[model samples]
Target: MTPSKRLLSLDAFRGLTVAAMILVNNPGSWARIYPPLKHAEWHGCTPTDLVFPFFLFIVGVAIVYALETKKIDISNHNQLLIKAAKRGAILFGLGLFLALFPKFNFETVRIMGVLQRIGIVYFICAAIFIKTTPRTQFICMTGILILYWILMTLVPVPGFGAPNLEKETNLAAWVDRLVLTENHTWKSAKTWDPEGVLSTLPAVATGLFGMLIGSILKGKEKPAAEKTTWLFSFGIIAWILGMFWGLFFPINKSLWTSSYVLYCGGLASMMLALFYWIIDVQGHNRWCRIFVAYGVNAITVFFLSAIISKVMGMIKVNANGEEVSSRTWLYDTFFTSWLPSDIASLAWALAFVLFFLLLLWPMYKKNLIIKV
Candidate 1:
């Protein structure tokens, strides 16, 4: 494959994940979401659950294409480590910046986050990429999943005895709560955290899973259909194994349950294959263009949206003698005010995404790219 074709699919895939991330994150209201947009409560898979892992998988895939296309010299181990540390620092900083920006409260700031996970995973996976062959990476990936499974199930929480994929009593949650601050953890679960420390172990499997896809995509001789077929088959197999594992480990994202990792990673791998088939293989890329625009500059769009959302929220306005957020007003005026229900909310989000894309289209048209 030529350099261009190698990464086109990866870009589209990354863009797809970013588009979905923004869409779901910017929904009008969490309470009034379409079923597809909402996250699974626990121990189950959802479209949203696939988003982060998909991004991680895409990251791995791109790593292969990038290294091959650039012909990165791997003999220099120190050079590689330094590069990894720098990239990891940048990504981790971005995550922390996001967590603290517009409200930099040091006392109880978010310690772990999406970008933070990416940074750590990027460092570790990059090292693995340089040191191991694709086959070895695959073996290591599976090994990590299995090892995590055994560890989580056997390791006893301070007072809970063995690992529990339940609530605050679980080992992972306990570690995060003990190490991180009360306000620094995932706010949704109150006392517990979904993005806790121990959970990150299996999360690495998600990145390794991506690396496998990346290596597959990088294989010059492998036909697209063959690759896609393998993806589907492996996805089904992983899903089955994950389900069986879940019977013993339970598919909990909070714990980053080993089963949940395989399950989500499997689902993400399959989805990547499907998207590649549909958009690149089938040559159907029209609808995905807007998302592509957003995806190419994913960090830009995401950071902008968060900042803009915060700014809009801060600018409260008096409407009919009642306090109203400026952001809500914007959403209502353009998205929900006159639109019908059912899909009006969805449309509003789509519109928000589109409007945001307008800002990015220019950068894309100018061939400006943002990456850490």
Candidate 2:
């Protein structure tokens, strides 16, 4: 693939993930959501839980594509690192701004979030990619995963005594509560943030997994068939290993467990392989333009959609002689009134996805790809 051109599959895959992310996040009524849309309460994998890590994996792939190792030399190293840092900072800042928005509550604002974790993982992975060989990158990725396993399993929580992977008493949750404090943690669970301090270690590993695959995909001499084969093989191996490992660690997305990394990363790898085979290797391009639009301006749509959702909730409109949130009013009037409860909820979420895609279409047509 040329530096100027992108693999259609990657964009389609990313756009699909982003679209799913929006759908899961914005159901008209949370109570009526499909089982697949809701995250597993604890210690299990759900389709909803896969979106974030998949995006991180895609990020890793994008890094390899963007900063082709063959092109960068030692002299350009500092500049590349700086650019990576700047991008990471912008993403981090956007997350922070979201947390502090509307209320501007510095005291009780959730400090760690999805985008913040993404930024941290991207920065660290990008730096590692630039400085290290594939061998070193592999070692680093494995080391982080093993180290996280050891920390979460062997290291005792401070006051709790033995190591545990419970919702609040686990080592990672303990660290989040201790450092980020109850006030600044996830609002839904004040005692522990899902995207907390120690959990992020393994999240970095997820990105590295992507970077490794990205490197493989970027290999110039390798045949497409060979690359696709290797990806499928490794993906299956990782998926099996993760399942076996889950007996001990449990596949917990909230914790970003090592096993979770392998499991989700494996699925991501296989999905990418399928996409690459169908889109790039097969030269099928006619049907991927919608996803390409979403892919090019992913962060832009994600951030804006989130902001818009919040704003909609804040704006009240009179409905049945009582003031209700605009979101609520719209949902009740059009969605629930026309469709079944669950279907209406899903329709509302799908509408949000379409709304954002509409916003992105013109930009994609103009090639106004916003990179952050």
Candidate 3:
């Protein structure tokens, strides 16, 4: 595939992932969310569980494509690494700002989060892609998966003195408490965090998996059709291994276990393969432009939509002589009144997606790419 075609497929895939994220995250009522949209209770895979990993995988793919030029010119290696670190720092800072918004509470602010993890993985993966050969990268990826499995399953928790995977008592959770502190961790589960420090090890593995595929995609030695077949085959093999590994490791998104990484990374690979086949290989592009629009300014919309939702929750208004959040008032008045409970929730979420689409359409038209 030519460079432009490869990018088109990637952008569309990323847009689809980000759009799914918005849908799952902003249902009108959390109480009314559909089963597929809700995250698994503890130790299973769900469609909703794939979104974050897919984003990270895309980040890995992006790093390979974005830094390939510098990879060739040895003189530019340090300059490229510096640029990657700066971008990573900005992404991490944005996540921190989001966590501290409207409260500015340093005392109890959640430090590790979705964007923060993305930033960290992106930084590490970018450096690896620039400095290492494909063989070395593959070995590193294998080592990370094996090492994380050992740490999580064999090593006993310090105070508990038992290898555990329980939500609060697990080794990852224990480290979160020791380092991030219980007070500064996730509020819902103060003793643990879904995006905690130790879990990030396997999260980086997830990105490496993508980086490997990206290296494959970037290779000129293979034809596009051959590359697609190999990627699809790899996806199937990795997915089956993940399911088998789940018996021992138990696929858990919160911990970002190795099994979870392989499972979701396989799914992401197949999805990207399909997009690449249809959009780039077949030269069919018009149908996927809406997703392209979402892709172009994905972080912008994701961040703005989150901030708007929170602000709406904070702003209260009088409705029927009772005070309620503006979000509640809008949902109750327009969505709940006409649609069934779950359907209304789904519809409200779709509206949020469309709202951003409309908001971003002009930007897409003007070719305003907001680089973050």
> What would the TM-scores of all predictions be?
0.90, 0.97, 0.97
lDDT (Cα, tens digit) per residue for candidate 2, span 93-175? 99999998899989899989988988999899989998988889999999999999999999988999999999989999999
Residue runs of model 3 more than 4 Å from their true location after superposition: 1-6
Q: With candidate 1 superimposed using the best TM-score fit, by how many Å does residue 313's alpha carbon deviate from the native? A: 1.0
lDDT of 3 by residue, 164-206 (tens): 8999889999999999998888888999999999999999999
TM-score of 3: 0.97
Residue 315 accuracy (lDDT) in model 2: 99
Off by over 4 Å in 2: 1-4, 69-71
* Model 3, residue 128: C-alpha shift (Å): 0.9
| Model 1 stretches with alpha carbons more than 4 Å out | 1-6, 69-72, 332-344
Q: Report the poorest 10 consecutive residues by lDDT, candidate 3.
A: 1-10
Pairs of residues at least 3 apart in sequence or in different chains that clash in candidate 1: 61-214
